[model samples]
Target: MELGYSDSVRENVEILDVVSASEEVGILDDVINQGESEVVHLKVGMKFDTVDEIYELYRKYAQQKGFPIKKRSSKKDNGVLRYICFACCREGKHKTDSETPLQPEPTSKFGCKAKLSARLDLDEKWRISVLVLDHNHETSPSKSRFWRCNKKISNHVKKKLLLNDKAGIRMHKHYYTLVVEAGGYENVTFEEKDCRNLVEKERHLKLGEGDAMAIQSYFSKMQKHNTGFFFNIDLDKEGRLKNIFWADGRCREAYKEFGEVITFDTTYLTNKYDMPFAPFVGVNHHGQSTLFGC
Candidate 1:
């Protein structure tokens, strides 16, 4: 069943078809001729004057299996008539000089084009190798959005912020003491009693009273000028303002009136210990103030 070039042959010749009686005799003759100088090798093997007798013996063996004998001219040496039998069940003429060698058709699978080759002589194994080539098919577009605000803010905050997820905006409760120097707020200091009262109420609801007061004061000041407020919320984290019913209702009204609002909703808090605080501030028509509440 094994097929390959004989070790005695110098050239890299591959035997493609099934081994026939004539082929075996031709191979044996080549082996003996190459090793004729060695006496020990010649003594162990029988010498054949003609390949015909060897082919006849092979014919008898093949006849038992109902195989037909064939005649072919040797490509190796011109004018050398060689007797062969088609042992392979499949029907195909032998490849000629003008015909290309048998090779697998190119195919695209497993992310690349693969080439296949069969070697009956070399262990009778099918070898497959991949080659990277440009494909004509179009590639799929990326799923991520180009102007992803959440991704930008998430990178700025060093945290993951998924869109449409419930989130809150508030002052830094634990680091409220640091806001005195942050300079973002208008008034930094309040009475000790006022701070204590606000803290008590905020602690009862687990929210920041100072932040709520800042928002309420801002909106009340804007209301003096009869302005509308429009804003957005980070719906990723749980926050007091995010859950506030009145502030959300007012924002919806403002959106309807102004057609659009310039609101920058971000969660990067000035105080590291505090949650993100999104403050919405904009100017509306008629020189009125548009504000975000809570």
Candidate 2:
């Protein structure tokens, strides 16, 4: 039977020297890379909340270092990982923009050879007990923001961003504020372009295609929901809504009395769909300008 590693080989792999837990993971990663060895036994004294914390930290660290990570849980419910491993990078497209899976999910595939096992010590703290981290292939470094999935913006953040966008804050400014609120750039896994894309996506979802059919649907719903509504849609020779006059009962009654001498203005406020929103105004007996029709 082929043993995992000889005692002599184990002697050279005592490479867990770092200040913080994240840094320890980083140091172990560097040792694994430099020594071309994945069989380091780390005796860490760090305290973590849960086994998942250790796994996520290590996984994030590995991905940041341009190494593909894989993990597996012992079971569901108590479903934190029994072990985590770094997979061999397949010689294919590594671009994050490309259409492919970036991080390796939990699997029993043979491609991932580097392994790590964690257990709770007597002090009620998690420790890396067994680590077999020797990779069979060479790897390259990658920017952490490009591939990290953990640092996604939550729905709460997105809502706040949308509000800021509507309030006239610049797109780049909102992104910068979000990064600052996140504590720093390291905490934000996604890039600035991704942030801008989210805003664009929200706008697209709100406005749809902005086509003629969409406009008609909106007006149809509005007409059905109102009882005092009066609207005249004038279609051109091409069967399009060329001109529209719409008003409620109150406005139509006011127009009957004041529509004789009206001032038309189409140069004021514009709509998002590039539709002209002009209004007619007339002077009432109170010597105040009153709206006649729109």
Number of clashes recorded per candidate: 12, 4
Task: Please give each candidate's TM-score.
Answer: 0.17, 0.38
The segments of candidate 1 whose C-alpha lies over 4 angstroms from its true place after superposition are 1-250, 265-273, 292-294
Residues 1-294, model 1: lDDT tens digits? 866656633221211111221232332222111221222211112233344543343333323323323332222225533222222111233333544447644332222221111111233222212111222233221211111110111121111111101133122321232122223222222222333444344434334536656656666665566554433322224445543322445665665677366665666654523454555655667767775443
- Note the Cα lDDT for every prediction shown: 0.33, 0.55
Model 2 pairs whose backbones collide: 38-132, 38-133, 38-134, 39-133
Candidate 2 lDDT over 98-156, as tens digits, reads 44467545432345456556666556676666555555555444443455443356555
The true-structure Cα RMSD of candidate 2 reads: 21.3
Which stretch of 10 consecutive residues in model 2 shows the poorest summed lDDT? 15-24
